[model samples]
Target: MAMLNKGDTAALVCCSNGLRPSEKQRIDTLADILGDMGIRTAVSAVMYAASTHYAGTGKKRAEAFMELYCRKDVRAVFDVSGGDLANEVLPHLDYGIFIREPKPVFGYSDLTVLLNAVNASAGMETYLYQIRNLTGACGDRQREEFYRTAMGGSACLYDFEFKFLRGSGMEGIMAGGNIRCLLKLAGTPWWPDFAGKLLFLESRSGDAAKMATYLCQLEQTGALDKVNGILLGTFTQMEEEGCRPRIEELVLNITEKRGVPVAATPQIGHGSDSRCLILGRNYCLNLQGKTL
Candidate 1:
């Protein structure tokens, strides 16, 4: 069912880090684009707020998120910022508030922490996508998909491209994104169950060394062993900078002979043309399948 009507409000939240002065334009552009689709925006109060490196204290950020969820006028919540501070707001989140008449919650990168937590605790659908992406080079398609699915209440159509890295026929509930951000759930109450889940990963920034270390840690947690397969998305900075020890190479070494199915796509992650992916849902993937 459609979560929004033509005149309903969709919220833009910054539950991670404060926006830089210039990023405000980016937000405006996003709102204008959505406005063209007849959806009004209700930006969160704490979006531009800051306390040194964060949007605010964890308590404040959590409160802002809860407030948005509780608003009857808000049809959906979209987080617009990405920073290392996202996980800090996790503990302060009142999971119960999310259960009452839940709306679709959307985010990506560090927002992964929020997406998975809500899915695990509240069983509400969450999106692993950056709303700012609507201003990107792929804006047209992004906006199309957003309107068709989120606003129109139609099923999703996978429009990105991918190629297999290990094996084929990887299928299971989608979980994980931005390896570093996902790992923040470790030892926390919100950590997702990995058993038979299709682990998806992408990155906005992080070098080969950082990825190697992250994979090592995740491997040690035995998550790798429990997942049904793995899917790699664009490793933006590393891919653009031509960083050595490419993510695919390191992943191959880390799982050497483990027989985990793996695939990759440059059409997702922080790419200019990145597409959206749904979290906490059963997905059957292949080089050609279009619907998830």
Candidate 2:
């Protein structure tokens, strides 16, 4: 993949959810921020197009994506926000176009479905980051990390301490996104193939019990059996009493028994200091060394 150089254009696409009246301000704000970084921004028509809770109809959203992908000026694509409807646009996307013209696509949360799908179907690399907060006044770190990752510069260092739960040294292609969103692809062709892969799981919201149930579902479906290791990202709003324990116990039960390396950090999901993770890339997760 080529680096996004000065004056390069990035497309701001809204796939899952429509922008609210207040969020329209973010479009201009993000553009200014990108401009300051020597990058230009182009807002997708679907950002303003609405059909109930979705940014637009599936076909409309897919068209917006295709337009950006096919544009000679556009070097990258960023989802404006994540919501429950991203999967609707999946079947409408032309993966063949991406195969011929691959570029970085960025988002997290509900956009996980698209992130993993694009990589699996089109063989393009996707990034996991929160796009909406990248330009805020207090987001300097995130802004810098995004610049570095998107521009193909140095790797974004994860600063949080990761508790090594099992195994030793491990290396595999980094995979996974929002856990709940990933589950949506279970029986579909879009479901990620985790064989010999480092699986990273994160969530924006959910109780421990609910998370345990989701993990159980993954275990039952044999999704947990094929991965080389597991990296747990920040689980926001899931720290209620007994919730963290159940979630940890479930992961430990599955990974530890299998001798799969496992670790956790509160810096990769919905948190303010979330780091950028490049999906479909090879990375080494060292449990004893506490690095990735």
Candidate 3:
């Protein structure tokens, strides 16, 4: 897939939350933003279809996604927003469709389930980034990285500063997403296989103790043991005085014993300047060399 250029059409999909009357206006602005980047946008028919907090019923949301995937003109798909119910639509999705005709799919947060599932089950690479609440250049770097990675460019080309906590260096396919969302898929068929993968974990509004518990779940499930390395992204709201241990300490304690290469950076999470990461693609992380 070449980099999305002028006239390329990207489908705007709302899989989790429904758009309210006030938020609907932002669609036009989002279109203008994509247009400035030389891309055309098409809103999913069910983007605003409401069904008890979700944009639509599970089947309806699945249908919306399939419609975009099968479109001859659509080059990519972008979720309009993230919410708590994307996993509900997972069972209804046709994973075979993604395998047969894959396109770049962009989203994060609640969409983590879909991103990792499609890659693990359907064998298609997906992206992690935001489409909603994009202000003037707030997410431009992320958008550019998405374009580059989706176009088959190496993720290592982008400059990023990382703090190495353990190990020398490692390389593997990138996997994992929003820590909380990922934990939700534990017993499901969509659960990602983290073995021999570079697991990137990020989250918002979680404290050190809560984060440790989440990490413990992974540890007990044998997921952490199989991963070759761990990249901890921004743990927002974790710096409050009351938060226990701090994120760095928690991560080191959890991963150090495993001897997996561990690194942390605030450049790839819910932060204002998060960059796009290509899930299910191979990446080289050199802690000593200060590269990814």
Candidate 4:
């Protein structure tokens, strides 16, 4: 495991493509928290590129992020916020540079675009967790654990509780993130090969039937057939009325035919409670272990 060395630093890349002043302050709070954890960090200006007001800054935004990617001193890259421009910067990214100098990358939502692209192109594992542009939500233990797993290089234990909906114990390389993000990459060269892996996923605000529809898409694309198991995070701010079935019940229904061990409501996704998950890394989700 490549742990964060005693004097190592973490580079903060805010995907601000466009950000509010309040958002900037949130990124600063993230930096301060990391600093308190004794990890050195650098806050770059990828923030401005995310706003509708900054449509013309795409070229400059890519250049800035590319520059940070090349810096040897940067041990890891953390995104500040996620919006729309990440896809714009995708084609401009140098995957070869990241491969040559691989480091753990972290962020979610819009960052999902970047994570899937990098993993597809460079074969380096990335993280899907709390965004850097949020404040006062994550606790210290969560922060320390996340950094420890991400920068404290080396495989760590990850046995989070899966409110088992149908199947039982299983283990494999973990993959999958935001439901929409995963679906977006479908049919693209960037879509991950999920065969024989644990396909962990969660979403925000979608009701059970909508969740079922997305899972069906994954199944139609043969994504479901590739997993060794399934783990779901809470659907934050989920609505009760959608003329659809219950979300958890829907998940149980989808995976029942696959007969794969399925777990639900694990500590993850679109909430302050979202825990860190290493994409492309091997993990075990079982009983009597580190159940979240």
Evaluate model 4: give its lDDT.
Answer: 0.69
Q: What TM-score does candidate 3 get on C-alpha atoms?
A: 0.90
Q: What is the lDDT of residue 83 in candidate 2?
A: 75
What C-alpha lDDT values do all the predictions have? Answer: 0.83, 0.80, 0.79, 0.69
Alpha carbon deviation, residue 120, candidate 1 (Å): 1.8
Compute the lDDT of residue 62 as modeled in candidate 1. 83
Every model: Cα RMSD to truth = 1.9, 2.3, 2.7, 3.3
Encode model 4's per-residue lDDT on 135-182: one tens digit a residue: 545565566565566457533323344556665577887778778767
TM-score of 1: 0.93
Clashes in each model (backbone N, CA, C under 3 Å)? 0, 0, 0, 19
lDDT of 1 by residue, 1-292 (tens): 6667799888898888788766788899899998998999988778775336566777888888888878888888899888888887888887787776777888888999989998888877788888887888877877887788767877553456678888867889988988999999988889998999989899988898999899999998899999988889989889889999899998878887688988887777877567778888788877666446
Model 4 regions lying over 4 Å from their true place: 49-60, 131-134, 144-159, 239-244, 290-292
On lDDT, the leading prediction is 1
Task: Using TM-score, give the best candidate's number.
Answer: 1
Which stretches of candidate 2 lie above 4 Å from their native place? 49-51, 149-152, 157-161, 240-246, 287-292
Give candidate 3 misplaced runs (Cα > 4 Å).
Answer: 49-52, 136-159, 240-242, 288-292
